[model samples]
Target: MPVLLTKIEGKGNGIKTVLPNMSDVARSLSRPPTYPTKFFGCELGAQTSFDEKNDRYIVNGAHDAPKLRELLDVFIDKFVLCKACDNPETDLTITKTEEILRDCKACGERTGVDMRHKLTTFIIKNPPKNPKKSKVKKATADGATTPNGDADEDAGGDSDDELTLRIKAEAAELTADAAIAKEDWSADTSPEAVKARMKAVEASMASVSLAPAGGDDDSDEDGDSPFAHLGHWIEENREESAVEIYKKAEEFGIAKKHNTMTIIAQTLFTENVLTEIPKYAPLFAKMVTSEKHQKSLLGGLERLVGVLHPDLTPAIPKILMAFYQTDILEEEVITQWGTHVSKKYVDREISKKVRKASEPFLKWLEEADDSEEED
Candidate 1:
């Protein structure tokens, strides 16, 4: 239902229905766009194309916006919206026997996926990863106070109801995706959003390691460094969150090293690190509190930013935005750090570029604060 706009590309038999709002809709459904796109293809008997890099989903033939939207509603009804409570907060869990179950958060009900549906086959093969910790965190936060002054066990609220409506309304937007600029600070902490972010980081890591070793990139082979060995641990432990990774580094004596922050900055966000930041903010509470650590943090960040393609410089803004949102990266700290340039962690030129890259986001944050004061 998310801003259900479609663009038709090409002519004759080669035409396709490109859902511009595909990613937005998937966010509403709490499922990946591939699931719904593949569902549509199976339902319509048409081939589907997925361009993950651009977040584009295309199905063969020209399908009317209303028709596809209707299909999306059906998909949501069966797979997304909880049956018992009619809520959107649910997790698809697969049992050892491979039975697919919908674990409803709102009503504590267990509903099985329709085994007869063709989508079941795909669902069975690609079981959606359960985001349990984030869910528990959200549930606790959403809990209302009881008359006894204890938090309610049943975490139902008007906020959830409002969220359900907002998702549908935003999806129906003909122009924008959602009011995220104002909301991401809070909403980015949700279970589904966190999972989506991890998946996105995994997708982006491919491009991060693409550039060669000449100007600003690391020259040593991935086989050379102790950090590379730590990175291997990250690859092997796909299910572990960043906090776990940081602890693992401690267990291996990597966290105490003077170079630990630098290594972590390189290896952290490569696997669900941003999604883990809010969950592990307490672990990093003192990270930038001191002048010495702040310098090290900025140095690590510079090294991490050095190898990425220049086109991705815009990411500096969003990275800073997330840090500011989570209160992990202090505004005063980042603003001061951005003004001074040093090559302590990375090449001299790379240090200058990363700071330059951070300037726009810092300026935006300053203007935002000024506007808030005026209001």
Candidate 2:
């Protein structure tokens, strides 16, 4: 691809480097124009501004064509090429576990991208607008249809008969297995058997305890679970300061639990959470001292956004950005949460919706990481 570099004067940043043909270059790479433009900003430690309306991609500070081309090559190697076959025919996918997988169509190899790179986060959030789907050509005895609808030469009649026999054998084996599975069930309902089962159930019930052992004083008030008690306390004492809440959690004797942060997150914020995050950011920063606590806090936010305030679902990206900017959540944790869909805190569909709403912020986080690395 050709690099068209120009010097733009009278801009906010004097003598800015402009890429007039960035859109065409991005088209050749099958990526959005913003990607390479933002990449240049990252690698050069310079501010970048994009005028999508006019197709103007500008980077602060003057840069030559050769230097920009070199950086573009690095971007292609890291993001575009297949590691195994060095093929550029690859697609990027973000797995449920937040892994960036580069799947090659030419070599049929699936490889992982370096998660440490900041570009990965951007790619995960942006992804391909229309991912190229690999077409499978099914060959028959008569002929095989190509990707373009062209047919190949015919094969022997024996090949068809052999394939048919194999398919029939597989189907018969599946039917036989199903029949055997159906025959393996039996239940006893005789009078003596029923009496024996009743006695065993009675004995098991007798050994169970309905209350805390030794009448523990620390048992939750009103027979609620510890987390429930904490949540109720926070809701009732909403006027209490963050420090007071932290102290109260300690008094509740459940401060050490993983779900403590989860309860706090769900109970503390309402629909105005985006504006309220900075107020509680310090508390969260202190409480989330470990990865487990971080994940628990995320679970709480998941319920807060996905269940408690479904109306705020559209603001997930902004909410996450607030937490990120305030140091309430780290990039690694946010990226991990954004990539995963968990039913632990909300329904699977709700979890997916929450993540989908967070894509824009996630992409910004990644691009920021790249710029930081350049610095």
Candidate 3:
């Protein structure tokens, strides 16, 4: 017969032949079951079982391990949030899987809250209990069978074999829970590391802002930022403007990659938009390379494309072709050029340019279109 490890006359005794109510056991193990039919609305999944060769319950692929893992993750997240806020103190209760409740523990009022700031005080309401199913484990004839032909009625994990299975299951659950705790700790730690990185970046930006804005020490500041000084010089002097402005922007943090792009983009077009490209090059290039900058890039590109004349775009193919012909550009420049052309061009109009400036870009577009069609 099996036994319960309980206090006997104010002393911790060995296992005694008395089983607690199944309802009391269920209340102690609080996480809800994912599969209603298999678990029967009981929190039995948390119990350990040492059934398989690996000393763990074989939650085989047939049993939907992935879905079960997802449920466990979500349940743990809710449990952590609830524990953080001492949720048992409040009378709030969450009902459905989709419904999230955010009420103040102190005032019992709905308050505007940022979970990031309230990391130590966030509660998720308990999901509604499913009362349609039974929580008790049904006793079977095999479970009641005893040695020497007498009936043995024990509760929880009854036989030695069943107890081993239960222990393995519990051990597996503890291992899984530990893994989840480690992941959560890593994620929480990352925010601190990210804050430090952001601070270092800001420091570098401040240093760049304070640096002298030209290569030549002889160059005069003209009482303003390098850009303003360049504009003034350009208004006074014509042929020297482009080189001087390009030089000035370099010292002010316009990247070398962008400078190359600006030169290529300007070579095939004749519009005043070239001036605007230099002005926004830093923001545009930063957006092009950064995942975080994607939203800003999308909005800026849409606005820029919307205001631009259709005539100005016709020169993109020409510029790309020139890029391909240069041995130095090879594939890197050609790829970026191709991306630029595709971002701004379509099939019918892509062939308008026949010059040395358009050939390479056109060939790339045709091949890309063919590959896409095949796929």
Worst 10 residues of 2 by lDDT: 131-140
Each model's TM-score, in the order given?
0.38, 0.41, 0.21
User: For residues 13-50, could you state the per-residue lDDT of candidate 3 as single tens digits?
Assistant: 32211112222222223322221212311222322222
The runs of at least 3 residues in candidate 2 whose Cα sits more than 4 Å from the true structure, single-residue gaps closed, are 1-223, 372-375
Q: Which digits, one per residue and each the tens of the lDDT, describe model 2 over residues 1-375?
A: 556456555545577888899988876565678878888888898888999879999988888888898899988888778899887756576778889888664454678877887666677787654311110112322564422234534444444334324433333343122221111112244557445533432222121111222233243444445555566666655566666666678777856555677778877776778666655655564465445676777877877787666898878776765565443466667888888888766668988988887887677666555554565
List the candidates ranked by TM-score, beginning with the highest.
2, 1, 3
Which scores better on lDDT, 1 or 3?
Answer: 1
For candidate 1, give the lDDT of residue 274: 46
The residue pairs in collision within model 2 are none
* Model 3 misplaced regions, further than 4 Å: 1-238, 241-246, 250-309, 327-333, 336-375
- lDDT of candidates 1 onward, in order: 0.58, 0.63, 0.30
| Candidate closest to the true structure, highest lDDT | 2
